[model samples]
Target: MFGEDSPEFSLRIFGDIGMHGDSKSDHSKANFSFGSLDFVISGSMGERLTFFSESLIEGEHADAIFFDQERAWVAWNEGDSFYLQLGMDNSVISRWNRLYNHGRWLETTITRPFLATFEDQGGVLPMHFQGLEIGGLLAPAAGDLEWVAIIANGRGADIEDRQRVHDDNTSKSFSTSLTFTPSSMEALTFGAAALTDIIPADLNSAVRNGSISEQIYDAYFTWLGEQLEWIGEYAWVIHHDGVSGSNFSHRLIYLQMAMPLDDWTPYTRFDLKVMDQNDPYFVPVDQDLDQWQQLLGVRHELTASSAIKLEIGFGHGQDRDAGGAVSSDDFISAALQISWTF
Candidate 1:
């Protein structure tokens, strides 16, 4: 504990050593990497207002480090029923993304689900936003209902670009999510979310001569029992090409389960993504293909603030070449990671 004028600060460090082999290369490589140095600063203003920020320094080596501001927000709350937040934050379209955030030490596995991966990490969805978030809770006779709505700048031409300071177009993006938990089964929860946005075509050739209309819908459920934990989610993405009058639908799904035994927890997960090859929005980004991965992992707690994880993954996918020819690829990977916080 600190004085009233002092702010709380914490740091988290993650590192991993891993090896991977793929059919295309027919070889394996092993390396030790620095995952990230996460810094968190948080404080409060009076009783109803509070603020917090998270930043990360990440790279494979010291010579090529990168800095990222993951979240910065000021929030106002009224008991447990309502709250308003403003600043940079994670998008709530995916439950896993909102739950785990940037703290790798809080997760049970070494890698995230495909749907929860960040855009810069070869993911297809927008995971962060800069703007406002409004949320609240309602208590019913049998259960509780939670809801959130967000307004922010739409994504830029490239998937990795977040448009943190400005917007490319006049239209803003909007999204909403709802979840319900029943009193009869306190460990079970379910939710759904949707988002709509328009991506301008000014500097992007992928959309031809017009803007792209994008919509996403997701449904998910989680069951956390005394002995077992299970989570599942499915998402559908629709992209409409204004120039060609074409619409493409993409699908993503994953299911994960974990069991805790003493100080060790073992987990398994399956992830799948299917895309339309002809969707221009995905072609330029090299995401217009089908992929699936299976993972098995176990976590061992070394101390209250530290843990070690071992994971092995098997993946298969189809890729399209410059000449519009498609080929299949397969890969296997394994990693050992030690994560800690202080």
Candidate 2:
């Protein structure tokens, strides 16, 4: 019989599909997807560290040889108050960003919160900072608090000047967060984080005239109980590049709740996002954007690690739509997901 200690190596296989109606174009395309393999290793070197990385091989970019992430890192435990980690690793800022694996079976929306996306705005922002981090518990109480700070190459993955104001430049991003688990008798915990990068003058080419660099300001919170959880975040961006109106502003607000009964859980969430197109530059061109989204979802847990889910949503453009005044795809989505771990 298989048990938790059957093997150290584990493999995970999963995929998600979304569609509307029964049309060829509408049914076959997926809004989000991923597949990967994993392994765990132990060595003669006392308390050797472990590592894991996932490459997106199917669903979104199915055929390309994409190295989406490479987190080959190691860590050493010094004690309860101190430890060290070296390699490419995700930042310690937001719970949603770090806890929500792509294969997770339950969520409030068909997509992630606007801030959770890894891009420039959401799809490719910095996910892993390649460097070293030293951190540990800062205080001991019924409700505990932990602290972390890292030194890394201030940019994200595969990003040239897009990740930071410089390309191949060496610098660091300083970040810290506080997490608390109150002494009260309730299943709840919360966290707050702040991050900033000091970029070099010569590498900052994004600015027009003066040698001002890039900056990021973020705050996040989460509360989870037996059956319900709440997540929220806010972020601000400041660019010191003096060309073409060297300023940028963006914000996000999301709220969601879920309840589970037996094997099924139903949920709903609302998202509001606003970005200034006039500052620094324009993406869609000539117009800023305000996006509003409403989502309703349900999930059926087949087991502790596997489940099936269905979701639907609608998006409204507050300003001009990039394609035209009318929305090109004001869509309704449905997805069936199956996930398991071994």
Candidate 3:
């Protein structure tokens, strides 16, 4: 799909093969499986607005139609100093494996963080939302500074109807982030964000009191070096519910370095994640978990419009013997991915 007369679109298909010598989950041995296919389509309306939609279809059902996200909006570009986008769209609040660019830079074989997904993990949080977003270049500080603000239906796209505007009091939520790029280092960018909402326990009714939520502080810095890219972030969440409390914090660090030699770019990564359990609002888990992963990836550019990527990873978890662990000793996986645009 290329244009409005034809339907502009893109696709990404991937598969993973792995051999495991562990004592954990089922299918611990060698296995081969398709990951997911990302399909997207867009159509332009004159020079001011556009319609865009994207979806993730997995396995044999890849041909099936399951709407993941669809947004139609109008945008105005009044010179280079400012731009405005208005309509139902994805939230511009935080950065995670899925929210930030696409799914290409992940160093792990599986996918992304469990908490960063759109699924329900004991009814905690939803991944995406419907809202009005406006962001653009703010000024020329030492180099460049960008600003973004969003005010949307506090409820995520998946649970929009479940939100009670009157009783829940979480009918709306707002978020914003400011990014700065120093003139000295063109490859480095840093930013901060804040989010607040009136969350609900379930979709029973629209009004659920005392279910409000807040995430006070979050910031990150990314550096794209000559032969490397590094990213680090930290966040703290506080809830009114006593059981859930005062300080719930998390820290994440990921570094990816690649060397370009001819048609191939070989890369490796190191990631560390920690969550504090001593805070008053700490959510206890079945086990205290820490994960270490090592990955080796090769990217082959077949053409200007398409490329292939092969990646392998070795993952290890801390204190595997004491408590029941998800993966036993260690796990390894290999994946082949193809991406293209039209």
* lDDT by residue (tens digit), candidate 3, 171-233: 677778788889989988888877776554434423321253545456767776766656555
Q: How many clashing residue pairs appear in each of the predictions shown?
A: 0, 12, 5
lDDT of 2 by residue, 277-314 (tens): 54322342322456667878888877776666677667
Per-residue lDDT of candidate 1, residues 220-336 (tens digit)? 999999799999999999999888899999999999999988889999999999988777666765787888999999999998878889888899988777898889888677778
The model with the greater lDDT, 2 or 3, is 2
Best by TM-score: 1
| TM-score list, all predictions | 0.91, 0.75, 0.69
Sum up the clashes in candidate 2. 12
- What overall lDDT goes with each candidate model? 0.83, 0.55, 0.51
| Stretch of 10 with least lDDT, candidate 3 | 279-288
Cα lDDT for residue 253, candidate 1:
93
> Residue 194 of candidate 2: its Cα lDDT?
66
Residue 21's lDDT within candidate 2 is 34
Clashing pairs for model 1 are none
lDDT comparison, 1 vs 2, better candidate? 1
